[model samples]
Target: MPEEFGPVGRGEAIQALSREVLIRRSLDISPSGFITIISIIQGVALGLLAQNTFPKPTVLGGIQSVTLLLVFVSVFYYYLTMSVLLRWAPSFLDCFLPFVIASLEIPPAFFLGNAVAWNAWLAGFWFLTMGGLMITTKWSPVSHFGNVRKAHRLLHDLLRELRYTAGIGGFMVAFCALCAHLIPWQRQGWGIVGAGTVLAMVAMIVARTELRASQIHALYGVNRPPFN
Candidate 1:
């Protein structure tokens, strides 16, 4: 390796790695956790509203179901990708996740949602590009620069939010596309009502998180900032 990429002493390397592990552990979240649960609630509530207020599906229901199943799989692929990234976990491919996601998810995204699919695709594209740069340039996937644990932390934080952004955005748009056909265009104004309801749900989720954080702070005298 070039001097620029030479290994730090073992002691320093160990300390850096230990710090990275601590941050990743602190930032870890499960797919069934609060943020994902709330997003699921948001998607479901909107889907229900559109269903009750619009034309019932007859034949298209099956097709929509299949299409949506695929879409869900796409989002789940993101979920899996993020789960690994959250811990700065390395793949044998050295970060081929986004490439895999882009290949498998983008097709369904294009079929399920135009703008939403692009949102999904863009997430994969970014990871693949950034990951490629990190790898080829000989940066540790977890630490790109020396003596900068903060950079490692930043990567964890960025991937966490990016996962949520891409996954939730894609799911929300997919929900609409799947159900929009149920309501005739003339009556589809109710879809807005569903959207509004989802917005309200998100607001309530945020409020609840803040409330819980405040309660924790009061009880334990620790700073508890609200987060997704």
Candidate 2:
């Protein structure tokens, strides 16, 4: 199995470790990090502005404001969920899910701005999309302590978590759509709260799964661990 990636000696391992350090350092100062900082600042400013402007909003303003806040929160929540829950660099296909999810929010914001109820119905599709992405992704598991069985089991658990995530999304879709249809038209704000709660609960579940999954990467040794 070691030979599969070619024999890794002490020198090669040290070089790998150095390269990993360099990469981490680069990411710390990366343009993406800078952009993320700027985005946080911008978001804070936008929140303050929205708070002042939407205090005494009209019916349309109220709907639009809540929708705007929901979309903003959805974007941050999903990104945080991906980071905290996955804790690994996903494949490109999996990485693309966030962008697709973000783009999907735009339609609800534009076309369904008339009511929170209508927005809740469309919001379900976002979770449905997440479910589909999890179902479709092919995960590559990390070998734990060079144990093939451990690695395989980790992979299985990951798949299981993906399925769990998908199921959560599916449930949320039904839940959101149901809220949209069942709730009285005048009281759709509760539907928005429900959608947010679903997202939060799903995040908690994924976070717990990831906590268990992270055991695969746990290291115990005298020397520093090698770069994976």
Candidate 3:
């Protein structure tokens, strides 16, 4: 290992890691907890909405049911990714992301309850919000490390990954917007929205996994691949 990347000493390394952990815990625990609460609310509300809205099978029932199911999965995926990010990386956006997710639950529920015809718009906005955040923000798990260069390198890598995520998000937003207008609110339209949501979810999953890998590299400092 290079001198710059070498750990200062076992005791100092432990102290640095421990302090970072403590600081993160203090800063992030509440945000993560709040996200979890919101996730529960979203899941329950969406479940009830699905139950009421899609009670019987019809000509387009299969498509609508599958689309709703995909939306539910997307919500669950968002909760998992956001909770992990809140727990691992501190950002000013933390204060806002949970509220955004909470607010989004309203649209679908309202649309279902009142029979509004804006599903495409709703889903398009979802992709745009999530992607925009992923592209715009910077988050890092390691702030204090015995090896300062390692910490900086990890932060750099994480930021680079965010750039890649942003590119994906940009694509998703454009595709979703185009689809939203083209089909608007047909059975096929919901399916299109579901496809865009899946892409957004995949991008989020990739970003989350990158974060986990960076956290692991920060802690373990293994020569092997971070994923392995």
lDDT of each: 0.41, 0.48, 0.51
Superposed on all Cα atoms, the candidates' RMSDs to the truth, in angstroms, are 15.8, 10.9, 11.2
* TM-score of every candidate relative to the true structure: 0.29, 0.46, 0.51
lDDT of 3 by residue, 67-162 (tens): 445555555654554444334444556656655655555455434321123344354445555554454344533443344556445545554554
| Candidate 1 C-alpha lDDT tens digits along 1-228 | 655756677556544558767656445643234235434533653354345323554323333333434344434444443343333434446334333533443343232223233323333433443444344324335443233455455444444444344345445544554455454462234334323333433344344434443443444355556552
Distance (Å) between predicted and true CA of 30, model 3?
2.4
lDDT of 3 at 7: 50
The per-residue C-alpha lDDT of model 1 at residue 25 equals 48
Instruction: Judging by TM-score against the true structure, name the best candidate.
Output: 3
Task: Pick the winner on lDDT between candidates 1 and 2.
Answer: 2
How far is 100's C-alpha from truth in model 2 (Å)? 0.5
C-alpha RMSD (angstroms) for model 3: 11.2
lDDT of 1 at 109: 23
